[model samples]
Target: MAVAQLVAGQNITIPGDRAYCFSVQIADWQWGVIVSRQNGSLSLLDAIEGASISDDRLLLNLSDIPEDIEKLTVYIAAGVNNTGNRTANSSIAPTAGMSARLSDLVDAKEYASIDISQQLTGQLAVSLIEVYRRNGAWKIRCILQGYREGLSKLLESFGFTRDSYAAAVASISTSASTIATASAVNREQTDTQAPVNQEAGDASITLVWKSGQGSLRSAARYFMGKNFKPVSDLRIGCFYELENGQRGMVYSFDASLEGSFDGVPYIKASRAQNQHFEQLLINARFRHKLNRFLIFASMMDAHDSWGGLNVDVEFQLPGVAAQTLSPTTLMVKPIYAVAMINFNDEQTKMTPLDEYFQDLAEMDRAFAWGLPWQCENNSDNEDQT
Candidate 1:
């Protein structure tokens, strides 16, 4: 006894490849009935022709519904029908629940015809669905998928390996450990502290936090679409390693995220405290401490023949002797996308990211700067150390 409400701009893609329903809801979840848009009325049809670039938004036209309709809890998303996976919305609300970008989807028809050897070739990422709002908001959803099998094929040609990808993440710090601390200085430097841990191999440290608050966001599948939900200051990945070797993730800064259609450039949006915190973080990561390595990793560019990315993690080492990261100056972690592609390749073509890393390097560096990660990105920290 449940009825699904429909809206004017609402777009509902039927389960099968058959018909697309627009401008109408069933008479109380009554299967197969939809109000049509052509005649300014309601009508049931076996199938309707659909276009890739069309109205994806489901506008709830209350005037078109029957008088008996009760409980008008319409399900209207900021989008329209897509050719396949990821469609673009014209009037997307800043905080709408789910909005897909056309760039994230590979017109299967176009994909089947392209290959790594082909020019202007790229892969598809399950274009994340964002709920936008007027306040300029975007949030992730649980059901969204990033890169799928079809998109994986495209990335594979570039050295993305069937199960691999090229990924770069940039982390910026303020002057010093200031944003979250009362004693934090806004200048571009912090008191020169000793490099905490500098050893040849694996070493752990007591990651001290200015306070016990603040949440950190991660771009991994594990951290997707969690911001919109009720989250606390604890457990957003912002860690605080205490003297006793215990660590806790805190929710410290207000964060907003925005990305380009291509997925290459994403920004941690939000002007208030979030941006300030970001500037501070970036400054510390690059300018005073280990900023250069962080920049390289964040702006490196994503490619198919993506050799696993190298993270030049330069955080405050509270104790270890500051020696060059000899033996291995940086930690290289293969992107999850590339790894997935590698696995898919074994099942499909049978190659690896490690093998094609060299071949794809030239192509990757071509448009690296076009990405969000800039060449030299950092802000002025207060502590001028």
Candidate 2:
């Protein structure tokens, strides 16, 4: 018997297997060394949108907060109470001018909270941001990075809304603007089919319809009031009126848009073409206000099949509104949906044209023909999952 040990830079062969005998393979990965450096790219901000004026909150200290924020809400906080503000860290000598520009504008009479934006600039060494929490009766510090992303997203889901999303977009500073102008999407063709509240004047929708790849449309919904807070998750669906005065439903859904309003959650939805059905996801984000989003889908051709490759959606909340509409009762609605076209390559090659119709129909089916179980009816949605 012979004992042999083959080492690096050496080759050995014995049996007559042509494949493995001539080839050298490494199964173990050589992760040379563990580099311990500060987590620079890791973000530590949370975006929040309050549905009603009372639910206003924000996660600050990062240029990328929305990457994980859940929903943007608008609600009226009690009111603003001004106070001289400063940022202090007991960890070391406080940096001069490290003071937070914006203070928590809590309602003077009540403790309702509001948003105040300002730079946490000046001489600073700690790259961390100050996050205040109303603990019991005092404010406590809660950081994002060292903390959990899930927790951050959860905490920044709700916010206050005071203006129309359309108007809000128009107001964005040139530096922060992410959306580029394009011909209005299939908004005109489908706007009528959508369940729009025209009575809520000063609000208009833009849309465009595409065929293959898919269609893309974006719109901002606005409610009139000084300070507004969404008390319940708003319901969205499409409908078509029949010749006989009957109406058929289209897509109806509920998703917490960019739970956070800042980076980490901002959207940059642009483009005039639907290369691979990116439109479907845009349509999805329409339910909520988003700053940036990326949706992928497949369309065999320019005439058939249209859906998402994958979807990334986000949102942000405007300042609180003085008044917000309240529905008489909670409405049952869908949260998530998927559409499958019966067409295949053998039949006609799912092309752009067909994909357009498929997506439009999908929009219809999403609302009128959603899943069997309603998300509103689901205990999970009720429990805030």
Candidate 3:
């Protein structure tokens, strides 16, 4: 069989098969998901299954679909850095038909594929494909829908508010008795290690270094049964784009060298050399004037592939209770966290951070800055671009 090739708005039907596999390959800044359906309505308000993503591709499965559910859709969203032109390739194939499609028999292929390239300008996400049931048969359709706003808004159109969707997923997962039981026991043990002591005061956050090579005495302190240490060797710095279009580090180490917050010299340590402590304190002062605050914690010696060490960070936001992000691994050299703070002077003055402690929980996901960074004098150019 000659497999059908599809383009935008084209669709194909596969009778007798209850499952289908959808996949995509794309350049950086693109990610995909399989949105489920039930009773003709999209079921994206809760946790979904069969969503798989690999390097440059996303793979989704449609299996054990409910009787009332008729279709499966794939959503592709742009990451934070998706501002230029890009290209993508995708296909839909029946798992059971894989062998026949590759056989010597004179037959049509059992898959449909497409190549797409377009300029994306500040869009949140897009709906690329759809697979549905038509008269007791499964069918696939190409949908090149685009949303200019962003992913969060694109999801909202399906009657899914971010909070509602997150709550639904949590509720469903918690309802799983086996996993719940195991998680409860695990939580009990983990809670013992992380002890928080709330005290009335201003916002003061401390990052402690627990593992790797470091002296734990001079900068270390005990606070109500908790240990606080600092990683002297590592550099925690910020990149800001001020409201005045003045973008760059707070204090430049050497004026002779050229550097911008977003552009090269992409190397920061050279700019931050021997002035890490001064830079951090300088960042703290301009909290009110900052338009964007991207914090980065990097270890210059983190080149080995064998193992990693743990580092702890604690925070005491004024009016907010004390909190800690404990024992995170320095698996990668530069770990970045985007601190989302209120920039409005009036709002910043009125609202105590303690009233909104929810943001602190997102620290663990601070694995990448989404921007580029290169270490000066380092020869290994892997992932530097």
Most accurate candidate by lDDT: 3
Q: For every model shown, what is its TM-score relative to the native structure?
A: 0.18, 0.20, 0.34
Return whichever of 2 and 3 wins on TM-score. 3
lDDT of 1 at 251: 20
RMSD of each: 24.1, 23.9, 21.0
**Rank order (by lDDT, best first):** 3, 2, 1
Model 1 lDDT per residue over 1-385, tens place: 1122322223222122111112221111111112224223322222122211112312221222333322111122222222122244323222212222211111111100111112111223322221121222211121222232333332332233422221200111231234235223322222244344422221211111122111223333256565422111110111122122221111212321211111111111111231212221211111111111111111112111112222112232222243221012122221111110111111211111221112122223332312222233221111111
Error of 1 at 335 (Å): 19
Decreasing TM-score order of the candidates: 3, 2, 1
- Per residue, candidate 3 scores C-alpha lDDT tens digits across 62-164 of 3334466665566666553222122242222111221101111011124666554432233446666776777777677877666766556666766666675
Q: Residue 253 deviation, candidate 2, in Å? A: 6.1
- Candidate 3: global Cα-lDDT? 0.39
